[model samples]
Structures are given as structure tokens and as C-alpha cells.
Target: MSKALTSFLGENLADLKDKGLYNIIDPVEGPNGPIIKIGGRELINLSSNNYLGLATDSRLKEVGKQAIDQYGVGAGAVRTINGTMDVHLKLEETIATFKGTEAAIAYQSGFNCNMAAISAVMDKHDAILSDELNHASIIDGCRLSKAKIIRFNHSDMEDLRKKAKEAKESGLYNKLMVITDGVFSMDGDIAKLPEIVEIAEEFDLITYVDDAHGSGVLGKGAGTVKHFGLSDKVDFQIGTLSKAIGVVGGYVAGKSDLIDWLKVRSRPFLFSTALTPADVVACTRAIELLMESTELHDRLWENGNYLKAGLKALGFDIGVSETPITPCIIGDEKLTQTFSQRLNEEGVYAKSIVFPTVPKGTGRVRNMPTAAHTKDMLDQAISIYEKVGKELGILA
Candidate 1:
């Protein structure tokens, strides 16, 4: 490699390590359920996004195996080419039904969906009003669109309204779009979508919501838009089949025209290989399960509440999370990392999240309590937290 490239990598790597910003990944030895094995050690997992625990469900596994037997493993081509199979159509149809939209289009992944959808519709002549704390995919998508991105304060409705009005009234752009995450991943706060939709209507702006973390956990398993009764108002409803659906891929549910446009115009849909047959079938079954029953959804909230109550009672700074996601806030990056490491050492596996994933001085060990986590597991996790917190001087 060139000396210039080597020098740049060396300096950045050392800087991250010295500052405790570098992440160390541990491979899981088994299924990503409430309990997981890492390096042959069993630990209560509070770090996975398998909110419903369907990733290892027998029913899903059966269908996936059957699909592989029938359709083979791969889709073999891009959607616009020969890759759009009957199973792919069924998945999209299921997504549209679950999301309460006229139509839907699937992509290779949630991140790719944003990259495809935003740039396909908006361009340099457009302006996008985005939440300052939206996922990185949204940020990159807006950049790819070459649109003028105006960031409003995180979950601050007044700031969003002010920015929306200014952008709409300025007449500098031909189209105005407002985008935000239905649930902020780090803090677990729900977006002010009701107010955002109100503002969007007043300004004739296109509304886009990426409910990657909210689907299957809210709206009786439909999603955040339907939870707020604004499914008809939002122009784009983006979601992932991975997080709550317990599979892989992403999609956009909207009017038939938008879906049609994406099928042809979205670069990812046109250029990238379609989702694997097994993934598509498993995702479809997962959505069906969510729509059929709220057993998993209710259980997820129960476990979440149980865990939150336990942590809050122990005098830890659990942030303002409205969903099942729980974040134990630790102010210093090194201390936060140490807290997480200690937790793992003691049989809990909640990982530390620090800058630049979150703001500096606001590092946290984010916990995701899933339906599969029983009260016993949560109680044990709480006990471990107390031990770690006291040892780390984070609790009284």
C-alpha cells in the first residue's frame, strides 16, 4: 500500500484506541436469542435487535428450509432482471398489507433501501428536512441525493416546524421532504410523528418515516405510522425485515406509483441481487405471525418494562426511552466501555455504545429486552448490573 494511506490509517487507529472509541467485536457461538454464547461462555444477551425472538423460531426455520428446498438459496439475479420470483412478490405484498399501504418494494437491506429510495425521488433541486439524530443510512441517502439537507433538533417539534416553514417558504427548492426515524435507536425515544405529519400537511411536504425499530413492536405489529393513525398521510414508510421481522432486507411501502417508480428508478433494486429465497420466505412468515397475534409484542413490552424498572430502581441513569430499548447512560467513554466489559465478565452481554455512534460524553450500554427474555433472565441481568454499577462507582 502507499505510504500516505498507511500513515493515515495508522494515525486514526491509534487515536481511536487511545480514546476508547474503537469497538471490539465478539463472535456469537450460537443463535442470537435472549441467551447467547460468546467465546464458549453463556451470557444473558441484552444487545441483540431480535426484539421478538423469532430469529430462532421453529416455524420460521421450517419455512426457510422448505423455501431453500423449493427455490434454492439465491435469487440469482437483480429484481428488474430475472430475480423477481413469486416469493419476492409475496413478501412485498405482505409488507404492503402489514404497513397498510397500497404497494411496497423490497431491497437487499434496510440501509440499501434508504440509499435507493431517497436518491430516486429527491435531487439537487429538492430540500430534505431530516432529524439531526437519524440513522447513518438516512444521512448518506440525503447526501447521495445532492439535496440541501436541513437538520432539525432531535425530536424537537418546534425546531422541525420552524425549519419546515422556512424551507417551504424560501422557494429555493422545487420539492420539500421531511424524514425521521420512527424510534431513535440510541435513546429509544419515539419521534413526534403526529406533529411532524401536521407540519408536513401544512407545507405540502412529503413525509418519510423509517420505522426500522418500531415495526413488530408497535401498532399491533404494523408499524409506527399505523400506530399514530397516519398511514394514509405519510408518503413513504421505510422498514427493515431484519430487526423485528427476524430476517434480512428492507422495503418501502407507499402508493403504487411510488413503488412502481422505485422498481425502475431505484439503483439498488435495479442493480443489486434480490434477497435470498430463504430470507424472503422467513420474513414473510414472521410478518404473518406478527399480524396474527400480539403474544410476542406484548411479551416484549412486559420484559422491557421489567428490565427498565429494575435498572431505574438501582439508581442508574437510564435515559428517556419510550420503547423496549434501554440505555444505561455513562458520561465518560472509557468508563462506559469498562462498565460494559465488566457486565460481560459477570455474565451479561450488553455492549457499550460511544462516539461517534452517540454524542461524546453521552456514551451508554444499550439494552434490547426481547419477548424471549423471561423474568428470571432479566432479574439475573439486573443483579449483574447492580454489581457492575457499584463496582464501577456508577450507582450508590
Candidate 2:
């Protein structure tokens, strides 16, 4: 390694640590489930993104293993070459059906999907009006596309409309697009897609929604687009198989032509190796389960409500979260980190969210309640939260 590169990285790491922005990742001793073991102690897990608990579902594990036995562990080449396997095609078809779209295309992950799809469709001539709170992947994708990115206020309709009008009237760009997360993960607030659709119609702008967090948890597993009944209206519906679906891949569900174009032009699909056989099959099975029953979905909401109620009752500032993604706003970065550490020391495992992720002075401990968590587990976590909050003077 070059000495200059090493020194640069070392300096940055020190700065991050000094600023309380560095994260210490915990290694789970076993499967990430309702209760997780780390540092030899089992704790009620609230930090995982395994929304539906399919990450450790016996059915998915069985199917994945069977798939690995049938097909090798890897997809040999890029999809454009020989990597496009039967399993991949099947997964795409399943995603299309699940998303209620005419066609769908899968990628290795949600970040790659965004990087691939955005640049494939939009160019430097196009301007993208994005939500300010959009995921980091969106920001990178917009940069990669070289599109003129105009950020609108978080879920603010007036700001979006004003920017849309300006972009259209400026005539400096040949085309325009609007992108947003279907559910803002940090805040758990659902995007205002209905109004956004109306705005898009008014401006003839291409609309894209990354529904990574909403899949399997919204619209009976169809996602936020279907939750709002704008399946036909929205142009690009991006989803991750990893989050609520509890597998490993991302996809874009849209009209057949749009998917067809992406399959040919998307760089990640053409350059990167396709998802492995086992991951594809496992994701497909997860989607099938989601479509079959709402048991897990109901449980997830129930647990979210339970936890939210508990935190609110304890006088912790639980932000306005419309979904199961909960954030206990602590305001101070050090306090937030200390709170999360205290929770781990006790019997809970919610992670801290601080600067660069959220605005300064709004540090928080984010909690993700999955379907696997029992009521007793939630109750215990709440009691721990109460204890920690009172001790820290965060609660009265």
C-alpha cells in the first residue's frame, strides 16, 4: 500500500473517532434473530434490518441450501455473458408478479441497482429532482449519471413542486426525473408518492422510488407503490430482496420495455456477476411466503406499535415514525452513543445514528422491530429503555 494512502485513511479514521462518528460493529455469535448474542451475552435485538425475520426462517434456509446443492455457489459471469441462469430469470418473474409490474430486473444489491438503473436511464442532459432525505445510494447514483440533481425538502410537497416547475421551465435539460425512498429509513416516514405522482404527471418527469424498506412490510408485501395504488403511474419501482424479503438482491419493477432497456444498458447487470442461485431461490421463496400470508406483517406492525407506545410512555422522544422503524431521538451525539451502549450493557441492542447520517444535534438510537420478536421480548426491551432513560435524565 502507498504510504500517502495509508496516512490519509489513518487521519480520517482518527477524525471520525474524535467526532464520535465512528461505529464499532458488533459480531453476532449466532443467527440474527429476535434475541442475538454478542460479547457472550444474549440481548433482545432491535438493531437488525431483518424486518420479516426471514433472514433466519427455516423455510428460506432449507430452500437456500437445496438450491446450493442443485447449483454451485456462484454465478460464473456477468448477466450479459453467461451468468443469467434459470434461477435468475425465475426470480425476476417472481419480482414482477409480487410488485404487480409488467416486468422486473434484479441486481446484486439495492445500492448497485440504483447506480445501474439511474445512470442507464438518465444522462448529463437530464435533471433529477431528489428528496433531500433520499438514501446515500441515490446521491451517488445521481452523481454517477452526471444528471443535474436538485434536492427538494424532505417529503415537502410545495418544495418538490417548485423545483419541478423550475427544472421544466429552465429548458437547460432535455429530460427530468424525480427520485425518493419509498420509506425514509431513518425516520420511518412513508413518502408522499400520491402527490409526487400528480407532480410527475404535471411535468412529464420520470419517477423512481427505492422501496428497499417497504417490500414485504407494506401493501401486503407488494410494497409502497402498491400501498398507494400507484403501481401503473410510477415509472421505476426499486426494491431490495434483503430487507423485509430477507434475502440478498435488489430489483427494478416497471413496464416490460423499461426493464428490457435496463437489461441491455444497465452497467451493473452487464458488468457485475448475477445473484447466486441460492440467494435468488431463497428470495423468491420469501416473496412467495409474504404473498401467502399476512401473519408476519401483522406481527411486525404490532411489535412496532408496542415498542413505540412503550418509549412514548417512558417519555423518550420517539420520532414520528409511520412504520416499524423507530428512532429514539437523544439530540446529543455522545448521549445517543452512550444510550445505545447502555442498552447493549443491559439486554437490548438498538444502534446509534449520528452526524453525516442524520443532521447534527439530532443523534438517535434507531430500533427495528421484526416479526420474530415476541411480546415478552419487546416488554423487556421497554423496561430496559425506561431504566436507561431515567438514569440518563432523558425521561422524567
True lDDT of residue 194, candidate 2: 96
| Per-residue C-alpha lDDT of model 1 across residues 1-396, encoded as one tens digit per residue | 999999999999999999999999999998999999999899999999999999999999999999999999999999888998999999999999999999999998999989999999999999999999999999999999999999999988899889999998898999999999999999999998899999999998899999999999888888899999999999999999999899889999999999999988999999999999999999999999998999999999999999999999999888999999999999899999999999999999999999999999999999999999989999999999999899988997
**Which digits, one per residue and each the tens of the lDDT, describe model 2 over residues 187-289?**
9999999999999999989999999999888897788999999999999999998899887889999999999999999999988988999999999999989
Report the Cα lDDT for candidate 2. 0.93
Error of 2 at 38 (Å): 1.0
Largest lDDT belongs to which candidate?
A: 1
Q: How close is each model in CA RMSD to the real structure?
A: 0.7, 1.1
lDDT of each: 0.95, 0.93
Can you list the residue pairs that collide in candidate 2? Answer: none
TM-score of 2: 0.98
Kindly report the root-mean-square deviation of model 1 from the true structure over all alpha carbons. Answer: 0.7
Give me candidate 1's TM-score against the actual structure. Answer: 0.99
